[model samples]
Target: MKVTQIPFQKIGFFSKTMLDYLEKNPKINPFYNNFPDFEGFQKQIAEKQTSFSKSSRLVLAEALKNQYESFEISEKTKTNISLLKKEHTFTISTGHQLNLFTGPLYFLYKIISAINLAEELSVKFPNQNFVPVYWMATEDHDFDEINYFNFDGKKVTWNRKDGGAVGRFSTDGLDAVFDVFSEHLGNSKNAQYLKKLFADGYLKHHNLADATRFIANELFAKYGLVIVDGDDAKLKELFIPFVRDELEHGTSFKAVSKTIERLANNYKIQVNPREINLFYLGDDYRERIIFENNLYKVNNTEIAFSKDEIFKELHKNPKAFSPNVIMRPLYQEVILPNLCYIGGGGEQAYWLELQDYFNAVNIPFPILLLRNSVQVISEKQARKLAALNISKEELFLNQHELITNKVVENTAIETNFKDKKQFLEQQFLDLKEVAKKTHISFLNAVNAQERKQIKGLEKLEKRLLKAEKKRQTHLVERITILQNELLPNQSLEERQRNFSEYYLEYGITFIDVLKIALKPLELQFTILEI
Candidate 1:
């Protein structure tokens, strides 16, 4: 959160098709359409009971304790329990890896978007209610990626020697990671606070689930955002039928593949699909899943859930099954009916691909909305442009073009030179007319003098231009430096590690100001400048 400067420029990451789709649908505000109200929003908007794929996909949920636990309940989860979730409660879901500490500003943005959107939904429909949900990416095996977060140019990494589904990893190893991160903070004011938060959550906690919870709760506790880890066995029980169908008939993979093909035809954009169903709780686990599959396996740890199950069992003894992406979404839908999902561009893209899979499984695919992203510019950066007598928009322009335009704007040229030259030509013409009347004697002399004057003016103009160029050499260097900073190999704003640089100039309320300025999301073509 250290202060720095935010360089402003347009981030044109979307394709022409995306822009066109957005532009053409001017009246259709996706988020508002889907999640305008909390009361019956899930049932009405999401169509949770509806099948996702033509093949009939169902929603699934796994419990808290293990990859697949038969019976276990943590006291903490029990204390935070809700009644067998009766009708229509508002829900906001944001996903994050089980980062030992909250991963990055991106993580903050995800949960923040959920909270903000939930608030917006509540206001729009004052009669209803809303709540926040954080979905933990606990079953994810990609430990290397979520193991670190970037701070400024430095990387803060947690080097846990063991790796599987990170949820299963013990939280004891996070202290070393914290120590390394603390050293990198190097005496910043907020560094100590961040370190304290990490220690209290990760080091003092019992597991990765607690670690994720503590960090997320710290940021979103005020907003009443509750976090859920779907790695529980009882939760996976709900997913049993879907797991059985996927294993027996191989429906998920087949259904998703067809959907992707059809989507590509519709949108003219290709999506990658695996021939084999990506739902791999394993064939072994699938048999033990009690899914009505033909195969028989032991009361194995992965799946042993029948269709007739209780919500309390999933909530209490959740350490039973492993929930993958396909199953996880189902779990969310089953646990709490949700109307829509507000997420980033990449997240939206992935969701589009999942729609077919949802349809096949008989679970409704929630409406997806792309969230707002921004680049913040500081007062000092604005002043730098003002001092240079150039607009920051010009800073965003190509460096060479900016310089050329600056040269033309600032160069001093004598307007009288053109008039003087014309006068000399007129004088020569008059002299020639006189010569013709009297004699051809001084005509040559007049022409010679006129030529000399023209040459002198041309030289004078060049000298003046040269002087202006000399005067502006340092300014040109600054522009070059600006280009180097702004137009590097990667995008400046997209890759920025900290939001403080923007906040330093725009104040802590910048996000609020942006929300007001940007709320009626129909306005397009932003050229944010310093």
Candidate 2:
């Protein structure tokens, strides 16, 4: 495999807030305590150690031990789970919804980033132990988002009427999905392996959570990736204090609302907080809990509880209360001795709004690291790209811009009017000088005419490019096909394609190639030629 690194901003896939945070802009420093760097980890380690209690650590370890009881995990993963009980151990975690067949290609990248970061951190701090964790978003209720994955330019989906948390969703409908998926995956050794993986993971497993755990562990068990499902009662018990605070004081609302107000001045806020960021969860229902008229009611439901009634319910059944996006991060931090969170652009953006909440709750905020993103191209495709003279940097441009650039490079016609526009403006400079010399009242009029002429030239230049594009339609089509191959639906491959697309071709070595190429702390986009 050959690899190239490009800055995330250059890729045009990240948000301004995420890019700004990565650059460590002083304006963002007030929102987050430490920049995610080597030295930042040192400070975060000290802070997390003081904040994460020993009892919580013990509970977390026991919970993991129970969670992994049935799965045949590697000894390395077992050791990592055992290490969580130690005071010197810290977790580097990345989380995702349980998308079928590991939805997008970035799913692998996110876990790989966490696993690689833990390994790097261990090498840096020899005395400390770092464990990679994949926190399953089992409590997520948005079934549509996690129901399908793209394969062979098609969405292989689990068609079912979904209700409640997706983790608890049955794998019954998945056998049909697996049959459809197997049809697309051609018969090869890798294909057979995938079939068995899907069969054992989904058909044999009882629920989505277990199926996802089996798949992830099958892929990354050798690397010691410990997967955790947060929908456990014992884990919910750890978050009782925050849940109680949210119910009574509306603490996340106060803190996150203020932070959003401040962040809105310079950046777009990803998520707005609710007055109560906890949801009332039932067997087949998960609804937002809204406090109104001194009564807590589940949204769109007849369920209502007074303060005393709700308090009693919470004490008896804390698992019934689920944290929303705002409080979920707090819950994750409270349960694990986590030092850093590895996530995608959107994940990091929302996390930026939470440091104030973490401060208000007096919990140590985990250092947020954007997960490693990769674009993988086959050797044949790489050769085609090279033959077309498309540079790695050129691939990041928007579809239209990339085609226009290539057309300009390939055509003999002058596609750019930049120099001509400059010269025309420079000529207007003399006209303005002449108008000024006469001191005429028509100076503004002269500038207006210049602007009009420039606008006309711009229109004419666009027309010329359009005409040229038609002349080189075949060449343009080739470039379009290439671009579409690299970026499906004009979006990042990692966002559109599934790992199975490559795993069928390269199998297990595909991951090994990625592990070799990905440098977690480098903080750049990776392009891999496989």
Candidate 3:
């Protein structure tokens, strides 16, 4: 396996907010507490060490132990969980929805980034321990988003009627999905392993949360990856004080609104804050908590509570209160002794808006790191790309742009009329001088003629380029076919395809290559040729 790194900006897929943050743009600096570097981490460790309490660490460790009691865990994972009780141990966390079979290929990239960062941090700060965490978004209620995954260009879906929190969803109907997915895999050793992995993960577990935890642990537990389910009552209890603050003062909405007002002038706003960022999570429903008519009411539901009643309910049943996108980051930071957060560009964009909110609640904001992105190319595909003489960076260009540039480069034609255009402009300049010497009205006619000639040259240049493309039809076809194969549906492979597509062929070696290749702190797009 060979690995190469490119800047995120070169890919043209990441947002300006993320690129700016990666570049340490001053305008984007205030939105985060520390940059993700060794120096920044040293400062972050100091901040978190002072802010995170010993009692909170004990609670976090005990909660993780209870959550993992039912499953057989690797010794590395067990050791990491126990080490969380120590004052010097901090977590490097990445969160994702429990997508079926781990949704897209980047799922592996996200967790691998966390694991690699932990190892690097451990080497950097030998006295301190860094545990990698995968925080499961079990409280998320969007079932449609996590119900299906693409396999061999087909979407294997789990059809069910689920509401409330998705983590609590029963895994009764997943056997159908497993059967369909199994049909796609042949009886090779790798294929059988995948089949059993899916069957045991989904068909055997009772709920989506447990199934997801089992699968993630099976994949990365050997690396000491600790998976945390945020939907647990014990975890929710730790967040009760923040939930109460959000309910009474609407602190998140107020603080994030102020940040967005200034943020919108420069970058795109990711998520808008509601008047209240807490949700009322029932057994069958998860609704937003809204304040109206001197009462706190759950939207689309008849449940209503006065200020005192809401606080009473919160203290009594903290599990019923869920944080929305605006407040979820605060809850994660409040519970974990985390130094950095690894996520995709979109995740990092929303996180950039919450620094002031974290400050308002007196919670330390962790350093936001853009997760490692990768494009895995097979040896055959890499050879095709080489034969076509297209650089890996060029593969990221728009199809039309890539075609135009490559066609112009390969054709024996002067498609770009740079010299001709410059010469025409000079001729026009000479004409204007003559017109100036003769009469002012003549200069307008001269200017009109110049514009006409320039337009004609541009038109001819485009026509020549089109002719060259027709002549080199073979080149265009090869470029399109290779690009389509690598970038399925004209989108990043990580977003469109599942990791099972690669695992079937390379087996565990595929994951091992990724674990070794992905470097979170480098913050670059990787092109791994296997």
Candidate 4:
């Protein structure tokens, strides 16, 4: 396996907010606590160590112990869980929705980025331990987003009627999904392993939370990856104070809204804060909690509470309240003694809007790290790309643009009209000088002629390029076929393909290569040639 790194800016997919955050632009610095570098981490460790209480660590460790009591885990994971009680052990966490069979290929990339960062941090700060964490987005209620995964160009989905928290969903209809997925996997050793993995993970587990936990643990437990499910009563109890504040003061709304105003001056706002950023999560429903008419009411339901009554309910049933997108990051930071958060660009964009909110709640904002993104190409594809004189970076260009550039480069025709355009501009400049010597009105006619001539040159350039493309049709065909193979659906492979597609061929070594290749702090797009 060979690995190459390119700047995220070269990838042409990230947002300006994310790219600026990665570059540590001063405008973005105010929205986040620390940059995600070694210097930033050293300061972060000091801040977290001073601010995070020891009692909270004990509660976190005990809650994790109770959560993992029934499952079998690796000794490394067990030790990491135990180590959480120590003040020196901090977590490097990444959260994702409980996507079926780990949704897209970047699922592995996110976790692997966390694991590799933890390993790197362990080496950098030997006295302190860094544990990798996969915080399961179990409380998320969006079932449609997590119900299907694309495998070998086909979507293997678990169709079900689910509401409330998706983690609490029943894994009833997944057997049919497994059967369909199994048909795609032949009877090779790797295929058999995947079949059993699916059967054991979803078939045996009762709820989506347990199944997701089992699968994530099975995949990363050896690397001491600790998976946390935040839907537990014990965990919710820790967040009760924040929930109460949201109910009474609407603290998140006040803080995040103000931050969004400032962020919007230079960046696009990611999520708008509601008057109340908490959701009422019941057995069958999860809806926003809105304040109106001197009462706190759950949207889409008849359940309503007065100020005092809502406080009583919060104290009695803390688990019934859930954090929305605006508050989930604060909740994750509050619960974990974390140093950094690894996620995709969208996740980072929202997290960037929450620094003031974290400050308002007196919770330390953890460093935000953009998770590693990868394009896995086979050796055959790599050779094809080289033979076509296409750099890996060029593959990120729009398909039409890529084809045009390749045709212009390989064709014997004068497709590029750059020299002609420059000469025409000079001639227009000379004509304008003559027009200035003659009359002012003549200059307007000269300017119009210049614009028309430039337009004509551009049109002719396109025509010549289109003609050359037809002449070199075979080259265009090869480039199109190879690029499509590498970047499926004209999108990043990590966004469109599932890990199972590669696992079927390379087995567990696929993940092993990712762990070795992904550098979380480098903050670059990785191209892996296998």
Candidate 5:
């Protein structure tokens, strides 16, 4: 296996805000407490320790132990869980939706990034224990987004009706999804392994939350990846104070709204904060809680509570309250003894909107780091790319631009009209000089003529490019085919293709190879060829 690192700027897939944040642009400096690096963790660790109490740590450890008890927890994971009770222990977390079969290739990358970063920090701060955490977005209600995963060009879907927090959704319908997958998987040993894996995860487990926990633990337990579902009573008990504050004063909405306004001056706001960001969770419903008519009302429902009644409800059933996107980060930070957050670009963007809120609530904001973005190419594909004289950088170009450039490169014609334009500019320069000796109107006419001539040259250049493309049809087709393979469906392979597609060929070693290749602190795009 070989690995190549490219800066995110060259990849052109990240947003300007993400790019700037990664580069530590002064504009983004005000939004985050500490920049993500080994040095940055020092200040974050100190701040988190000052606020994270012994009682909170006990609650967190107990919740994790209870969650891990149902599964076959590895020795390393048990140790990591025990370490959470120690003052020297801290967590590095990355949260994700319970996407079926680990929705995209990046899901694995995100967790691997957290694991590798925790390992690095353990070595760096030898006295302190670092644990990698995968916080399951169990309360996320977006069924349409998490119900399907792309395998090769086909979408393996679980077409089922679901409601409430997705974590509680029954896994009874996954058998049909498994049959569809089996038909595509054929009869390889890896396929059989995956079949059993899916059966043990979804078919055997009662709910989506447990199924996802089983699947993630199966794949990553060796590295001691601690999985936590936030929809637990014990965890919510720790967050009750903040939830109450949200209900009383709407603190998060006020602070986050200010930050969003300031952020919108230069960057796009990722998520808008509602007046009350907490939601009321029921058996088959997760509805927003809105304060209106001097009463706490659950959106789209007739259930309403007075201020005193709502406070009593929160104390009795803290788990019944779920935080939306805006408040979820605060909830996670409140419950865990975490130092940094590892996430994708979009996650970081919304997190940026919450720093002011974190400050307002008097909790230390965790350092936000974009997870490692990867592009995997086969050796055969690498060789083909070389034969076409395409560099690694060329692979990142947009589809049309890549094909156009290849067409021009393969054809025996000059597609660029730069020299012609330069010559025309020089002629115009001479004409302007001559017109200067005559009249101002004559110079204006020369300027008009120059514009007309440049427009003509541009038109000619387009026609020549079209002619060259027609002549190099075969070359264009080959390039298109190669690009499509490298970037499936003209999208990033990690975003569209599932990891199982590669696992079939490489087996479990595929994950080991990524663990070896990924450097969470490197903060660059990686291209790995296996």
Candidate 6:
């Protein structure tokens, strides 16, 4: 949201294009207002439960225990937990789909947004509690996406035979990752901090769930943001009833299905329909047998669940079930005692597709907020704009369109017989009106004569404009070269290329300087060349 203005030179030229474009196009995206509406929805949610709800408390307790167990809660998580206990008026909650080594810097932006928002709300709400909660994407099924970080010129990736959930992937599998990271850190003064971060989190942890928890805990633990993994025995117990209902009535698909269909009517994006026959899983306690069409188990254990019995047990203990697609929001509602969930653009889209399911389950849908995204510019990019006589604002325009504006503005058409053509067209219009009284047929002849005259003038204008363009061909060529160098790739700063480009000038404080003026939620990446 904060940056320099477009250069003064290009602004004057773009102003004319702006005026022309405004004449032709209505200035709004047609899809802008079709957002998921909350009419009568908030009341339904508030009525469902508060943080004080039994299910909500259970979720928090389970998440805390899981995070503690996962990381061995060095003094770090303990300190963070203590801060939360002391300042429990409000908390920010941010969630991510487990990306390999935390996908992009946007992941960082999501958490930072949650944290900053919680801080803002604390000032406004004064007496209420706020805590920033990180929902560890422990259940995400994709492994290929969540396994690497691009550093320097090399991709530091996990070499593993991945299957099932990333949460349960063992930490010991990340040794090769640490080796690469250590090599990169190589004798730097801050190597120790980076090394410990990798060690206690990656090398020593057991899964993506644990490693992410450790890293988050180390950074914001002191600030009281709690990281939680949802996949745990105790946590599953909280949503046991919902889980059972999904299996019994085949409700998840049926319930969430209705929402998706309803959403398809309004939102442009359509979500995949939820499945009705859900997968059944429980600890095997008998002979090994694969149980779907048949039965299966290992180590003297057999699958002990039947669809009906699971439901019966869940009905007996609502606190014991975990909800699938139809039930997750119900479970999250029951457990988190949260007021809102801050999500990324795609995440918000999917969440919008599921509101009807929340309605079906008698759960209130949480507030869905989109995280902000941004581009960073350096001193060089800023100066380049000025030198080109292009305003900083022009950077936001499509590159080709901006080029066309520059070309048209600088081109000088020869005004050969300009007034004569305009004067003749005006005379014809005057004659057509006067001729109407003498004979209605004569009026038509006069109108045709005016049209021919206008066409001739338009043709002459085109030729003049073409010659003017030819005369300024060198300038047009220069602008095209600059446009290609500046754009072509959409990024404001080429991140994968280098940070040393800025860091050499800023030194170790480059990160601190960036974190100062910008909110973490505003921009996903930044390239600050001092």
The regions of model 6 sitting more than 4 angstroms off are: 1-51, 69-90, 151-156, 171-173, 178-196, 277-305, 309-329, 389-393, 407-530
Q: Pairing residues by index, what is the TM-score of model 6?
A: 0.67
Give a tens-digit lDDT track for model 3, residues 394-492.
Answer: 999999999999998787767889999999999999988899998788999999999999999999998998888889999999999999999999999
Question: Where is model 2 more than 4 Å wrong at Cα?
Answer: 418-456
lDDT of 4 at 263: 91
Give the TM-scores of the predictions, in the order they appear.
0.64, 0.95, 0.97, 0.97, 0.97, 0.67
* Candidate 1 global lDDT: 0.54
What are the Cα lDDT values of the candidates?
0.54, 0.91, 0.93, 0.92, 0.93, 0.54
Worst 10 residues of 3 by lDDT: 407-416
Q: What lDDT score is found at residue 285 in candidate 1?
A: 31
Report the lDDT of model 5 for residue 336: 93
lDDT of 6 by residue, 1-530 (tens): 24332232332322322222222223311211222123322332334334345444544654586558635444644544444433233345678766655555556556766776666555655655566688876655466777776655467778777655567676766777777767876655566666676687776665667777777776566555677666665666666655545554555567556655654453444346444323332321112112354221121344355556545655564432323333454555555655566765556565655666666665656655455333445566567666768765566566656665666777564445668787997898789779977887888888888888888888987677666657777766776666555443443323232333233344445445444544432322232334
Comparing 1 and 2 by TM-score, which wins? 2
lDDT string for model 5 (41-74, tens) is 9888888888899998999999988987779989
Predicted candidate 2 versus true structure: per-residue lDDT over 1-530, tens digit per residue? 88999999888878888888889887787888777799999999999988888899889989988998899999999999989989999999999999998999999999999999999999999999999999999999999999999988998888998899999888888889988988988899999999999999999999999999999999999999999999999988988888998999999999999998988988888999988899999878899999889899999899999999998899899989999999999999999999999999898889999999999999998998988999998899999889889989888789899889888888888878999999999999998988997756779889899989999999999999999999989889988999999988889999999998898999899999998889999999999998
Using lDDT as the yardstick, the better of models 1 and 5 is 5
- Measured on C-alpha atoms, candidate 2 has an lDDT of 0.91
Model 1 residue 520 distance off true place after TM-score fit, in angstroms: 9.2
Give the distance in Å from residue 95's predicted Cα in candidate 4 to where it truly belongs. 0.2
Q: What is the lDDT of residue 337 in candidate 4?
A: 95
Error in Å for residue 375 of model 6: 1.4
**Which is superior by lDDT, 1 or 4?**
4
Please write out the lDDT profile of model 1 over residues 349-401, one tens digit for every residue.
Answer: 54556665666666666755444444344455556667777764465565656
